[model samples]
Target: METRSRVLFVRAGLPEPALNVEIHDPDGGWLATSDLVWREGRVVGEYQGAHHFGDYGRGDDDIARRRLIEGSGWLFVDFTKGDYYARPRRLALLRRLAGHLDCALDPAGLAAIEDSLELPGPPVRPCGA
Candidate 1:
């Protein structure tokens, strides 16, 4: 999933983000290890799986971790399975991430990536049939 996310960002002309980076406080205390980190942009992204929100009781811990990271003056972004798979959600996520990174998005690149996904498209019909 991390690889897929990276591909999505790169294919959309967004800068490639660092993977599994450990964030720390100024005092050298460990905050969290984010799935995606843009140190220059001070942005941290997490791909939350089912365990994070399911009955496993990790949601509270995740929230606390996010707070710790945010308290240190970093923007935190999270993505769920739906956010990665659903077209609308994926586009929104990419836009949001780009905005956080203070970068412009390439609509053409994004469109090309979407086309390359090879998902089922509308049926074709003979002209004037």
Candidate 2:
């Protein structure tokens, strides 16, 4: 899922967020270990796979952890399989998120990704660069 998300960021021409990072509070308290994190932008992304469901999914502790991060002014993006599989949708969504971080996505890069998707070839985990 992290690889897939990285491809989306690449195709969208957005700066790549650090993978598997831990966000901390001002006093250096552990907040959450995120799948993707852009500390300067205060944006943290997590790919919530099906395996994360059950009592582990959004439990009381998880909610509190989220609140801690959000209270520290961090923006969190929870992505699912849909966000990873659909390249176009991912690109569009990345554009929106990038905008929230005061960044821009390159149109040509997204267009190229769309073009590649139409090619006749074996499916790649992340067809984008």
Candidate 3:
């Protein structure tokens, strides 16, 4: 999942993010270890498989963890498997980043990336034909 997320960001020509990053404050307090993070953008994204959202502690943990992270002014981007490989969903993720940072990303650059991505596993059609 992390590999897929990394591929998505890199292919999109966004800033390559650090994976499994342990973030801390000036006082050395452990805030959280994010899945994929663009530290300078204060952006962190997580890919949660469906099981993680079930009747388990994982869901609660996610809620608390996101709250803690966001409280400190960091933004969290959450999505599932389908959102990763699909072009429209992936574009939405990038748009979120551009909006959050108040910048416009080059559409042509992202379109180029989307054209080149190859997903893992059997065929799943893109969100729209």
Candidate 4:
């Protein structure tokens, strides 16, 4: 999912983010290793899978981790399966990321990427009977 996210950004003409990089504070204290990190943009992206919501209070841990990272002044963005697999959602997500990173998107590039994906097309309408 992280790799896919990276590819999505690249295909959309956005800067590719680092994968599984450790974020650190000014004092050099390790904050958390983000699934995706745009260092210059100070943005962290996380892919939340089933493990993130599994038993053993993992959800709580995720919330705390996000708080810690945000408190350290990094913009946190999380993506779930839905956000990844859906086309419209993916476009929206990319736009949101672009806004956060102050990156301009090429509409033609995004259209090409969307065309390349084997996603299901829009619903068909029945002719008037």
lDDT of each: 0.81, 0.72, 0.73, 0.81
Return the lDDT, model 4, position 6: 70
Colliding residue pairs in candidate 4: none
Return the clash pairs for model 2, or none.
Answer: none
Off by over 4 Å in 2: 56-58, 115-129
Cα TM-score of candidate 2: 0.78
* Residue 10, model 4: Cα distance from true site in angstroms: 0.8
Model 1 Cα lDDT, one tens digit per residue, 4-111: 776678767688788899999999999888899999999998988877878545888898999999999999999987777787888889899999999987777777
- TM-score per prediction, in order, is 0.84, 0.78, 0.76, 0.84
Candidate 3 differs from the real structure by a C-alpha RMSD in angstroms, to one decimal, of 7.0
lDDT of 2: 0.72
- What candidate 4 gets wrong by more than 4 Å, as runs, is 115-129
For candidate 2, lDDT tens digit of each residue in 83-112? Answer: 655766665667767876788777876676
Cα lDDT, model 2, residue 49: 75
